[model samples]
Target chain A: MEWDWDFAWSIMPTLLAGFRITLIATFLGAIVAAVLGLVFAILRRSSNRWLSRGTSFVVEFIRGTPLLVQLYFIFYVLPDLGLRLPALMAGVIGMGLHYATYAAEVYRGGIESVPRGQWEAARATNLTTRQTWLHVILPQAVPPMIPAMANYLLAMFKETPLLSAITVLELMNQAKSVANSSYRYVEPMTLVGVMFLIVSLLSVIALRWLERRYGRVSQ
Target chain B: MGDWAGYLTLILQGAWVTVKLTLMGSALALVVAFLAGLGRISHHAPIRWLSTAYIEFFRGTSIFVQLFWIYFVLPMTGAELTPMQAGVMALGLNVGAYGAEVVRGAILAVPRGQHEACIAVNLTRWQRLRHVILPQALPLMLPTFCNNAIELLKATSVVSLISLSDMTFQAQVVRSQTGSTLMPFVTILVLYFAMSSAISFGMRRIERRVTRGLDGVR
Candidate 1:
């Protein structure tokens, strides 16, 4: 029960190795979420009713379910359907896909914050839709969303532990393996908790800086 | 089809466990949310600091780590918790940390006029909070509380890691038994979505009923 410094020291390398994978998963997953979320947001706003509605339903369904279950489906079931993926890849994709729905909402909120006059002005200037979006709208819409998007980044970072459920050898999984072998739960579990706490606190500090710099979207 | 029905029944039993965990976890979370939330704004410095620390510590760590620590580490200290108890405690404390912020924000959002009116009427602090502040704040908290409850529901799936026979865990059982990976996972996903949608729908109804006569409020 007592804290074992020696044992903790020995396991540090393994845990850190796992932490590296965690960071990589989180980084790749964030990219996927950011791009796909933008796509979903845009699709939901499309003039075609079916496309908009379908995208909306997809977002809702994804948002409603647990990431753990999604990860399970990807890791365990997909191979049966002839689309087998490595555990890390599946975890990253599952993480990205689940969080994309949340990120889509953030994107939608930012896009909506753009003024109606801005759109009309784009049309008035005879700017092509692509030029209007690329030059005028997104430039305005995206900056204010940085802070909110970063919040999800931290959320996704914390959720990286769930990636362990799919056997991705992330920090939680690494810690569990150590615990199972050594029969010393206190050290590994405590270290893992501390590691997450330190990163989360630092991320929160960074989030505050982001909020200050970006000036959050008003309401 | 008969065997499929049996699998469905087993998963539904697991779904019942999931519902129980959600309800119990949410109940504990509500209490923790109010106490820690109000504590964050307390007159006493130590109480405020304690509340802030509790909120931050719980919020800063992921729930999965917290659950594992409670289930595995705590037993070393001689306080062994059943898997169900650990799940409820971890989910409650984790979501409660988030809910505390919601509680604090909603309470703060109450108009200054209400507090001034309480003072003018010479209402004691307890009376002011009970009658004036909380009544107005409750409606504001409900929407976010609904979201947090759904978060709690999703979080219960993490308990399956600790060997709790919740829906996600049961899906694994079904998968192993039936050798149909797709059906078990797909079934649970639908069940989870249904539960979350129900939570949202129920919360909206409660919100409507609460805000009925409070025009210009909420």
Candidate 2:
């Protein structure tokens, strides 16, 4: 079959809309993750054993399972308890929550990697715990986390296709809808693949540069 | 949804398929990963580029989107494989990309001093890679390899979209039949949790055993 640029171009309108949703959902979801990860990472290292243990359990629980099923629970099962979130909201929530667990470990590793002498210096200066973390440790920790965080961001973008299962018409959903309605799987999916390739290649290049730049600083 | 008889039977069926696919797919991905991973770090520029391209293409694309392409596009292209084949192929390819990273990282993680030691001992390339490098890399790779294997298992649910009778598919089937979406899906969710947790728990034991050998080396 010959390639059909006209057909591919027409579907671009819907696909673009879906791409917007996918981008927003991923970007916003990543923000949630960055915050939740910091919270859980700190909680896991807290002085209180109960708080640390409880946070660890929650993180492990979320990380151990599939995001798809978790999203199903958020989107499908949650309504049973009379809390009906919008499909997009539920999707971002599920994706954010599931990835937060993984990101928390990343944060923990970043935090713990600070040299012990740094802590001693802060202590010697009579810095509060908050002051020490904000001033002494975090600035040292966050740069290395940037590349890892970028990887997660790209991963989250790829995962936006899953939100379609919950009726959020992200990129893949639009491609599927076009395929289903037009009875032409060839062009739309091909275009979708190209679009994904472009986006993710950009992600790779951006991530690589970030990794190299911050990697030098962290070391 | 502790309706034991119903959920148990459904999840059991899904669990069987999940385990089977994870094993089969990971097995395939591992074999290819070793080659591609080595290719990635090869002295030959073309070999390195080829592996890098392979990794980036799969890594960049959504696994579910790839699943759809295999399931939908391949049929239109006249390669009429089953849903299972498409599902397995997508997953093996996806995990293979990740496994390449693990393998390459693990190899690089080997101490540079060891490479000098191998050279000083007059070890051949194959001997150094097989007897020295890979042995050390295996233990380091195991934890990450197993994690990807579990993620692939969780990913098997995507095959349900193409009509594979996987766990998520079974859950969907049960939900539609019973008109009770929450219970059916909740049961499926718990089954995934149990299966993944079990995999991680088992791998953790193995990680401990592996690390035990390396203890006090530094």
Candidate 3:
């Protein structure tokens, strides 16, 4: 019932191990979100009406649903349909796809902020569509996006706790297991909360630096 | 396939609970948002610091950990709470922190001329805030508040972990009873989307009414 420093020190190793897994899942998930979000943004802007509308609908549907349920579906239901992924893989993908919808909105804003003249200039230079996107548009668009993208990365990190639901040994799961076995809820749970708070505050500082370095997207 | 009506009825009952939690959580969040937001801009330094600390603490931690700490740890300290109470507190406080920022931003966005006019008219601080400031800022807060409400709804799904028998929990129950994983999840997903869209639609209507004359400047 009281604060126990010795007990907290005893569980430090296990919690740190769980913290590593949490970091790994978040890192990989950010990569997946960044790439897939770009795809969603580009697809929604396609010339074909069906493609654009369908892409937007899918993005909205994903955005609307809860990521916890999505993770349950991916980890439990998909295996029934002959797709079985490792628990970590399922967790990372669920986090990535859920956040991709948000990141897509950020990317759309960044891409749109590039002036119409840039597209015209690319065409004037006789560049192909692919060349224009690669050489001219994205370079200008991606820099301003770094700060917003980093914000989602930190959000995804905070969400890693949900991975515990699907049996990934992330920080929350580790803390829960420690509490369950040792019958000491206070230290483990408090440690988990403090660890998360520290990391998130640090990331906010880093995000501010990123915004200053890369320049923020004007909303 | 078996007893389709029974399954639908059970899920609807759970959906009702989800709706209740969302409504209760949002009401609590709105209260916290206003208090903290106003506190952040207060002239008193201690009040401002305390508000900033509350906002940062809630915003910095994951909602899951907060829920666990409230549900599990509090009982140990002899402050027991029902699952519903715990879920509402966690959801409200978490989203309320984010909403406080929105409230602060909207208040700051109100034109300086309005505040000057209040000073010229010799309005007290309370009068200035109630009659002059809030009416203008309320319109700007509506759209962002709608988003926060939807986020709170999505977050209610996390309460299923604590055996609250909410929509997501009932979906899990349905999955076990019917041996069908996909249908229950898909159904709940659609239900969540409908709820979110409904909130957006209702907020837009309110937004239009509130901003009826203000659109000229905004």
Best by the TM-score measure = 1
Question: Of models 1 and 2, which has the larger lDDT?
Answer: 1
Error of 2 at A11 (Å): 1.5
Candidate 1 lDDT, A1-219, residue by residue in tens = 689899999999999999999899999999999999989988999999999999999998898889999999999999999999999999989999988998999999998899999999999999998999999999999889999999888889999999888889989899999999988899999999999999989988998899999888643
Tens-digit lDDT string for candidate 2 (A1-219): 566889888889998998898889998899888888888888898999999999988887787677887888888777877999999999989998988887887887788778999999999999999999899999998887888887888888888888989899888888899989989998878777888899999888898899889883221
Better of 2 and 3 by lDDT: 3
lDDT tens string, model 3, A15-35?
999999999999999988988
Model 2 misplacement above 4 A: A216-219, B1-4, B112-124, B205-218
Clashes of each: 0, 0, 0
- CAPRI-style grade of the A/B interface in model 3: high
lDDT of each: 0.93, 0.85, 0.93
DockQ of each: 0.90, 0.70, 0.86
Model 3 chain B: weakest 10-residue lDDT segment is: B209-218
**Candidate 2, B1-218: lDDT as tens digits:** 34658765876787788778878887888888998999999999999999999998899898898888888888876899888788889999999999999999999999999999999999999999998898788888998887897888778888877878888878777776666777777677777778888888888888878777676663
Model 3 chain A weakest 10-residue run by lDDT:
A210-219
Q: Candidate 2: interface RMSD in Å? A: 1.4
**Candidate 1 segments exceeding 4 Å error:** B216-218
Candidate 3 clash pair list: none
Worst 10 residues of 1 chain A by lDDT: A210-219
